[model samples]
Every structure is written in C-alpha cells, then in structure tokens.
Target: MSSTLAEQRAEWRERIAGIGDTLRAESETNEDLRQLSPATEAALRSVNAFNLCSPEELGGVNAHPRLQTQVIADITSHDSSAGWCALIGAHESAWLASRLPDSSVERIFAHSDERWPVTCGSIAPEGEAEQVEGGWMVTGRWGWASGIHHSDFILSMSRITGQEPEPGKPPPLLCAAAPKADVVVEDTWHTLGMRGTGSTHYRYENVFVPDEMCLAGFERPPLRGGGWLARPTVTFLTAAGYGFPLGVAKRAVEEITRQATEHTRTGQRASISEQQHFQGDLGRCVALVEAMEGYGHHLFEELLAAPINSLEDAVRMDDRARAALRWAHQTAEDVVRTAHEHAGGPAVYSDNVLARLLRDIQTVSQHVIQTQSAYIRRGQHQLGIPVRPGL
Candidate 1:
C-alpha cells in the first residue's frame, strides 16, 4: 500500500476509535428516535466515515475496500446503526461518483465544502422513469432507503417506460439521482432493529432527473477511480457488507464477557464467567467471530490478487465474494445468538446491550445479499448446474 493510503487508514482508525464512547452513549437515543442522534451523525461526519468508498479527487477518502470494511466494523462495534448508515452512505457516495456523469458528480461533490455529501438510495427498480424533453420523470416509492434521512442526494432505480428488452434479457433500468428536497421520505422505518439506519420508504413523484444525473445500469465501468473500483459491483461491495454483522457480533461477545465477570444468574453460586458451560459457549462464539474476520480478510486479499480480465473471471469473483458474505452473515448471526442466550435473563430487556446486538444482527442477516439462495447458487455453480444470472 502507498504511504499516503496507509496514513489515511491510520488516521481513520484513530478517528473512529476516538468516537467509540460517543457512539455507545448515543445508542439508546438513536434507537428511540429511529435515526442517528445529531451527535453521532456529527461524530461520523467529522471522521469522514461516509466518504470512505468515494473517489479521492472528489474530496473523499476513497480508502481501500478492506480498510473501508474495517472502518465500518470498528464503528459498528460501538453502534450497529451507525455502522450500517456509514456503510450505506459510503457505498452510495462511491456509486454516484463513479457511475454518474461528470456534471452530476461535480454538482453533488463540488459544493460540499463543510462535509462531503452523503448519498443513499434503493437499487431495486421499484420506480418508473419516462423519458422527457430534457430528462426522465420519475414516480414511485422505494423501500429500504437506508440512511435516507440525512442524504443530500437520493438515487432510485427505475424502469424506463415503454422500453422492453430482447429475449433472455432483463428490462432496461435507469438510476436517477434527485436532490433530497425533491424526494419524500416516508416514516416507515420502524422495525425490529437497525432503526437508527432510518431505512424508511422514499418516493419521487414525477421528479425531474436530468439526463446527466442518471446512469443506464449498475454494470457500467466506473467513470473515475483506480483499478479497485473496476471490479463487478457485487465484488466491490462484498467487503463492506461484512462489517455490520462482524461488528455487532464482536460487540455481543464483548458484552457477554463483561457480563460474565460481574453478574451471576439467580440460584447460581458462581459468577457466569466461572461456569464451564458459559465458558465453552463464549469460547466458541469468540472463535466463530474470529474465524469470520480472518476469512473475510483472506477473501479480500485473494480478490485483490485475482485478475478479472473477462466476464467469466468477474462472475467467478462475484460468486466467491458473495458466498463468503453469506457464510459470514450466518456465522455472525450464530455468534450473536450464542452470546445473547448465554447472557441469560438480563439479555431479554430492551436496554441490555446484548439484546440490541441480537436484534441488529438478526436484521442484518435478513438483507437480500445475505440470504440462503446465495449459498444454493454458489453450490449450483460448483456442480455445473445452470444457475440464473444475478442470483
């Protein structure tokens, strides 16, 4: 790694570490408010956490994918919602900077002198875009708009009206970016966990997105950035996806460990830590989390070294990256569950740290990318079975 990049990583590590206490302190408020507390948001902004994946030329850190994952993991170790928001915002910023036209990129990043812009959107083609004189008129509501509450620009994927694809091809999709003012953020974020992500519904009603502010499809090559951004979007995003679950699981393990030392269950003479059963469970959880982290790091290293010279190469890399993610998600969920279960009665309370960690990890495990179908597809690929594209 270049010295400059190494230095940037170190700086980011220190900055995120410094805010650990604040993130933890604000966790309750963030959950209660169903969004990040102002303090938490400001602390993250101060660290430039939301720009880690964006282009350096656009005044973003543009850290390596591994570094980005570590940053998110570290932040998530403190607060899962903060970590989720950071990852989503960083990825969206990178996508907009690398995929949108130069004019739109400049418009979004140029004027943000105080802080780099935060972008959040839904990638599902839930909206419709009709071609107009100067651009497309978008109208539809999209769910799971994570971090949309604080985004400066919101992107929505829409199908072009009256456009059809050839046989064996999918419908034509366009991604349109509109200023936050143009989008209506509906209060639909209430959920089982990860509430601070504010992943609510957002709608664009005939919102005019200029031609320059739209990208034809997600598979297009980056308009800017180094070789790292050239990988398929799935591979590029795989690393960041590891952070949320790992961080939350790590925190759960820590919380249980701390609880064991100080708290004893009713009718039990010894502290939780002194019990062989608890020790065994905690040891297994620790090992599982460590294994997940080590595997994720190894996968990223392999990805960096692997060449992607052809479509087949890209598909192979995507398969491995996504498969690793699915495994990590499952492992993390297991670790969190063990931790929560061993934490005993206190863990059932809403204010318990393990309770929150359990909820957050469970919510993350439900994400589309972490589903079991990914494993089936990877198995099919290995067995020479015909797997559908984009599975």
Candidate 2:
C-alpha cells in the first residue's frame, strides 16, 4: 500500500476504535428503538463514517476497497447494527454521488458543512417506473431500506415500464433518487438481528423523479471518483458485505474468550477456559475469523488490482469476490454459533454480547447475496456447466 493510503487506513481505524465504547454502550438501546441511538449516530458522524466511500471532491475519504472493508470490520466489531448501517449508508451515498447528474450531486452535497448526506435504498428492481415527459413516475414499496430513518435521500431500483430487452438481454432498469421527504417509511423492520439498522420497508407512490436524479442502469461507470469507483459495484459491495459477519464473529470470539476466564459450566469444577473442549472450540473460532479476514482482504486486493476490460472480466471478479464472501459468511456463522454454544446459559441472555452476536450473524446470513446459489454457481463454473450471467 502507498504511504498515504496506509496512513489513511490507520486514521480511520483509530477513529472507529475511538467510538467503540459509545457503540457498545448504546447497542441495547439501539436495539430497543430499532435504530442507532442518537449518541451512536453522532459518534459515527463525527468521524465521517457514512462518507468513507464517497468521492474525495465531495468531502469524503474515497477509501480503497480494502481500507473500506477494514473500516466496516472495525466498526462492526463494536456493534453489528452500527457496522451494517455504516456499510449500507456509505455505499448507497457513494453510489448516488458517483452516478447522479452533476446538478443532483451538487444539491445533495450542498449542506456538507452542517452534515454530510447519508443515503438508504433498495437495489432490487421491485418497483415500476412509467416513462413521462421529463422523468419517470415511480411507485413501489421497497423492503430492507436500511438507514432510511436517518437518510437524506431515498433510492429505488425500478423497471422501465415500456422498455423490453432484446433476446438474451436483461430488462432495462432505472435507479431513482428522491429526497427522503418524498417517500413514506413503513414501520416494518422488526427482526431477529441488526434491528438497529432500521431496515424497514419504504413506499414511493407516484413519486416523480426528475431526469437529473436518476440513472439509466445500475452498472454504469462512475462519473466521478477514482478507479475504485469504476470497478463493478457488486464486487466492492461484496467486499464490504463480509465486514459485518467477520466483525461479529471476531466479537463473538472476544466475548467468549473473556467469559471463559470467569465462566464455569454448571456441573464442572474448572472454569470454561480450563476445559479442553472449550479451549479447542475457542481456538478454532479464532482461527476461522483470522483466516476469513486474510482471505477476504487478499481476494479483494487481487480483484481490485486486476483490470476489468470487459463484462466478462467484471463478472469474473464479482463471482470470485462473492464466493469468498459466502464462505466468510458461513464461516462467521459457524464461529458465532460455536462461541454461543460453548458460552452456555449466560450466552442466552439478552444482555450477553454473545446473544446479540449470534442473532446478528444469523440475520446477516439470510441476506440474498449469501445464499447457497453462489456456491452452486461456482460449482457449475468449475464443472464446465453453463452458469447464469451476472451475480
């Protein structure tokens, strides 16, 4: 890494670590309120955590993928929900900032002196957009709109109503960015884990998105920022996605290790740390997290370093990064489960960190990107079978 980049990474890591106590202190309240606590949000804003991936010209770090991943992992190590929100918020904002027309970008960043804008939206093409004179009228209810409660802009992916693709081509999709005031947030984010993300469903009914505020497709090259933004969006997103599970698993390991020192099983005489089984399990968990981190960082570095000259190249990078993420997710789930199981009765209590780690990991594992289909697709590719295009 360049000296400047290394220094940048160190600064971000320290900044995130500085807020660790605040995140931990507010975690329970955040869960109860189904969103980040005010203090937690303020701490994050103080460090510009939501703008890490945004363009440098727009008062953001414009961090590299590896650095961004580390930032997410570090933040997640303190609180998974906060980490999740940071990940989603940063990426969404950067996506819009990089793709939106100059007018929209200027307007969105106009208030950066007071507070940098945060964005939340769904990329799934569940909404429909009807073409009109200047822009499209969008109407749909998008689920899992994380950080929507605190977002300045809401984005939705929709299919253009009258556009049909040629044979073997995907349908034309448009992404519309609207002011948060233009959308209605539904209180439907009650969940098993990562509840503090406030990932509720949001509705856009006949919302007229101006032409300048929307992108024609999801995979267009960025109009601003460095080469990092030019890479396939899914590839870096996959890189960032692993941070939540990895951090949670690392936290699980830390919590269980600490508990092992003072925790004794109900029927056992020795402390949990003294037992061979507990020791071995904790050792395995630690190794799993370390390995996952190394693999993820290495894979992302390689993916970003390679030149993506064609669609095939982008798909190849996306597949590799995604496959690694899936493994990391499954491994993280394993680590958290093992830690919880061995932590015994205390791990079940709501106050216990292990309990929350377990729930967060499980919830994150259910994300569509972590599904088994990635594995199946990888297997098909290796077996000389025709795999579907794109991730």
TM-score of each: 0.96, 0.96
Q: Residue pairs in steric clash, candidate 1?
A: none
- Write the residue-wise lDDT of candidate 1 on 55-85 in tens digits: 7788776677778778999999999999999
Q: Write the per-residue lDDT of candidate 2 for residues 48-122, one digit (tens) a residue.
A: 888888888888777887788888899999999899999999989888888888998898898885898899899
- Candidate 1, after superposition: displacement of residue 59 in Å? 1.5
Question: Candidate 1 at residue 156, lDDT?
Answer: 94
In angstroms, the error of model 2 at 323 is 0.6
Worst 10 residues of 2 by lDDT: 382-391
CA-RMSD of model 1: 1.5
Q: How many residue pairs collide in each prediction? A: 0, 0
Candidate 1: TM-score? 0.96
Question: How does candidate 2 score on lDDT?
Answer: 0.85
